[model samples]
Target: MRTVVFDLDGTLVDTSGDLIAAGNACFRDMGLGDLLDPARDQKTAVRGARAMLRLGLERAGQLDDAVVDAQFQPLLDHYARAISTHTTLYPGAMAAVDALTADGYRVAICTNKPLGLTQQLLTALGIDGRFHAVLGADSTPTPKPHAGHLIATVQAAGGDMARCLLVGDTETDAKTAAAAGVPAVLVTFGPAGADMAALRPAALLDHFDDLPAVVRNLIG
Candidate 1:
């Protein structure tokens, strides 16, 4: 079957707010209140926990792996508790997924987020059933930007790697698609916004409403 793989954070949902809040929660634990700005650091937020933690620690002159490592789990704990508090699905996200499925495409999620947390967030959003598979950072020995990770996800979804495409919002996604020899469609609404075009993906998606057409053009 043809497959459509999506990145979790910035691709399908705006998870930056929750991610930033979690990082701030870690800072508060260290007696540093709100070290990261929600609006300004949104890009870093979607990059994952470590990036947010490192940015906060740097701002506080405490850039140490030990500090970040120690605070990492706490940050994840905080995020897991309030994963969807400020996270929201991008416009037409569900509709697009449905359209693809109706068109006989198998859809899946391949995220850099840990499997447990990814499942938690998707479940919280009440949309976990929408995907055929949800592969996360720890789902395999390797993660995004590695062909094996994406290829493994495709196989898990009962898809042919030759007939797969990736929809995402960052360079990581683009690189992963490239490594897997699949076409990549980068969303313009992500942290990098219109500038995501710099990554030179196979296509640039401005909205989920336009995704089905894009996927057809690329994969069919």
Candidate 2:
């Protein structure tokens, strides 16, 4: 069977607004000015919450590990409360996932988001049942940019790495796929910085609807 793995944050979901709100809330609680610019920081949100927090806190000179950790619970609380308040699947994300799953592809998620929150968001968005497996950063000993999680995901889906494809919007995802020996398709609409053309993915997709055709071409 073929397998397709997806990145959660920017690739599938437009979660930047919620993330920025959370960061702004954290800064507000600490009496610091907002340090995140949604336009500039949107891409960074795909790196996961810690990275977002680090970026904002560093700019405000408040990124001490202890202080950041101390603020973790509150930040999460704020985020959880507003999780879907500003989040939505990118255009065509749900349809693409559904079509891929219906076409007998084992669709799964491999994101750097924490397990609990990832599950929560997936469930909230009513897409939790779509994936055959979901691997969060905290779900394994190592996260993306490390092959363990991807390897584990492929194994769990009962598919060989050679028959699997990783879909994401970051260099980390490209590197992870390379390390895991799985071909990757980079999505241009996600949080990538350098031109995706430069990353030289197995394929580059501009829209979610383009996925099935790309996969067919890959596995044909």
Candidate 3:
């Protein structure tokens, strides 16, 4: 079946709020008191935990790889405690998923988030069963930007790589699709939405309401 692979943090859901909070929690642990702003640092948040840590450390004049490495686990712990606190589904997200599923397409999540945390977020959001497969950075030996990650996710979802496209919101996702020789339909609904055009994805999605049609145009 034709398949749609989605990037979790910035694509399907607005997870930036919770993600930024977790980054701030790490700073708070250092007695720094929330170095990252939940609103202004959203793009960095979706970039991943390390990105947030880097930004905070830079702001605090303490950008050190060792410090960031040390705080990684604590960040995850704090995130797990409040993973769903400010996270939310983007407008028409699930409705779009249901639309694709109903139209006989296979849908799956391929996120750079750790597998355990990805599971926690999806479960907390009550969306764990929505996809045929939910692969994270640790799910396989390789992650996004590597074709293996997307191909492996397609295999896990019982999808043919030749008949798939990615719905995502970052250049990482664009690179993943490019490396895998597939179309990338990037979403324009977050802090960096306008910037997605520079990545030159097969299509730019302004809203989930336009996704099913975009997918069809790209791969079907």
Candidate 4:
């Protein structure tokens, strides 16, 4: 069975704007007052909340692991309240999904984002039903970079792992696919798009408009 699994944050949607805002809220509570700039820190935002908090706290000369842990939930709280305000699906993302599905491929989302938040964001974006299955960090005992996450996601989507492709925008995603012995297709339009080449994914995708051909080449 052919399957395509996607990473949520930077691969499927540009959630950096809202993610940065949530990190900034935590910084403000620390009296740091928006230490991370939205435009300049989109890469860190895509890395996740702890990375954003670390960047801001380090910038303010207040880097501390304990502090980051303490503020994590609050940042998540702020994120949940306005998760979709600035989040957007990458251009032609869903259409690519439709094309793949129509060609008899099953699609799933395997992301490091928490399960609840993944549901929230997908539902808010009104694209939850586009996927056959959605698995997040909490869905498995081991997340990305571990073969289990990809294997479990494939099982959940009712597709065999033998003919699978993983699409993402980060090294972790590439590593996950490698561990699962599947091809990794990294998107090249995110903040660190240029740097993705270093990860040595099976393919580099510049735009979703070209995904169907790319997936056909790689998966078919």
Candidate 5:
């Protein structure tokens, strides 16, 4: 089956709020008083804990490896407690997944998020069963942009790598697809907005409703 690999954060859902909240929690504990802004730091939030922490510390004028190390686990702990509190799938996300599944595509996730947290969030969302496979940053020796991560996800899902497509919201995803020799469709609604087009992915997705046709065109 043709594979559809999705990036979890900005691509499939808006987890930016919770992610920023986690980073802010770390700052709050350090007496830094919530240095990150949800609206302004959404992009960093999607990039993962280190990016969020780095941005917050930079804004607080305390950017350093020691501070990042000191706060990393605390941030993750805070995030884990309320991971889904402010998270929500983008409009038409599940509908498109259902449509793709019905159309015989093997849907799965390949994210930079850690495996345990990814599974926890998926289970909390009650859609853990939707994906044929879910591979996280720690799932393989290397993650997205390294090719092996996405390839491993496809193989685990019993999918055809030659007929695979990646739906993501960042330059990293585009690079991953390029490395894997698959088409990458960058979503326009995420933190990168329409500017994601500058990454020059295989295609630009303005809406999830447009995805099925895009996938069909790319791999079929």
Candidate 6:
């Protein structure tokens, strides 16, 4: 059976609102103006928490490393406190996961989010037990776009590297799969914006239900 590795943020869930709220909280705490414009802020959400903090700090002209770090923890803490408040699975996400699981495909998560937070969000969303394994940014020595995490996930899932597939909504996921010698599918509904089209994934999916069909087409 082929192993399917998923990225948590954009691929599985629409987390931009929560991330923007966290970022805005951080900015507000520092007495800066709001930086949560959905059109502008959603793009940065795909880049991970540090990038989000940097964007907010840069916008506020407070990009000093110390200030960034100081704001980072609090923002993440706020996000954690409100993780499920505004987050939801994208359309068909749960169905797709259930379908994949019932089909005997090993499903796992390979995400850039911190380990504890990843677990918290997954559990809060009620999908934590669906994955055979969950690999977070800190779970490996290096995170996505580095290949180690993907390789480790495949191993944990008892899958053949050549038969494994990575599904995500960002360039980092594409790069990670490429480095690991696995094919990747890029979803169109994430925070990646135009960058998703440029990644040239093995396949592009506009809906989660299209995933199983894409996999069948690829492997068959």
Give the lowest summed-lDDT range of ten residues in model 1: 190-199
Question: Of 1 and 2, which scores higher on lDDT?
Answer: 1
**Cα error of candidate 6 at position 192, Å:** 1.9
Question: lDDT for each of the candidates?
Answer: 0.93, 0.85, 0.92, 0.92, 0.92, 0.85
Please list the residue runs of candidate 1 whose C-alpha ends up more than 4 Å from where it truly belongs after superposition.
Answer: none
lDDT of 3 by residue, 130-218 (tens): 99999999998989989999999999999999899998989899999999999999888976798999998899999899998898888
Scored by lDDT, model 2 comes in at 0.85
lDDT of 1 by residue, 64-153 (tens): 999889888999999988999999999999999999999999999999999999999998999989999999999989899898889989
lDDT of predicted model 4: 0.92
Off by over 4 Å in 5: none
TM-scores for all candidates: the values are: 0.98, 0.93, 0.98, 0.98, 0.98, 0.95
Clashes of each: 0, 0, 0, 0, 0, 0
lDDT of 5 by residue, 1-220 (tens): 8989999999999999999999988888889998888898888899899988888889888899988888888899999999999999999999999999999999999999999999999999888999999999999999988999999999999999989999999889999999998999999999987678788888999999999999999998
Residue 78 of model 3: what lDDT?
93
Worst 10 residues of 6 by lDDT: 33-42
| Candidate 2 Cα deviation (angstroms), residue 1 | 1.9
Q: Which of candidates 3 and 6 is the stronger one according to lDDT?
A: 3
Error of 1 at 206 (Å): 0.4
Q: How would you encode candidate 2's per-residue C-alpha lDDT over 1-220 as one tens digit per residue?
A: 7899988887899898898888789888889878888878887776666777788889987678888778777878888888988898989998998998888888889988888899999989988888889988888999998999998887777767878889888888899999998888998887673567799999998988888999888864
1-220 per-residue lDDT for model 4 (tens digits): 8999999999999999999999988888877898888889988998898999899999999999999999989999999999999999999999999999999999999998999999999999999898999999999999998999999999999998988999999988888999999999999998779889999888999999898898889878
Instruction: Evaluate model 6: give its TM-score.
Output: 0.95
TM-score of the candidate numbered 2? 0.93
Specify the poorest-scoring 10-residue window by lDDT in model 2.
188-197
* Pairs in clash, predicted candidate 5: none
Candidate 5 global Cα RMSD:
0.8
Error of 1 at 210 (Å): 0.6
- The better candidate by TM-score, 3 or 6, is 3
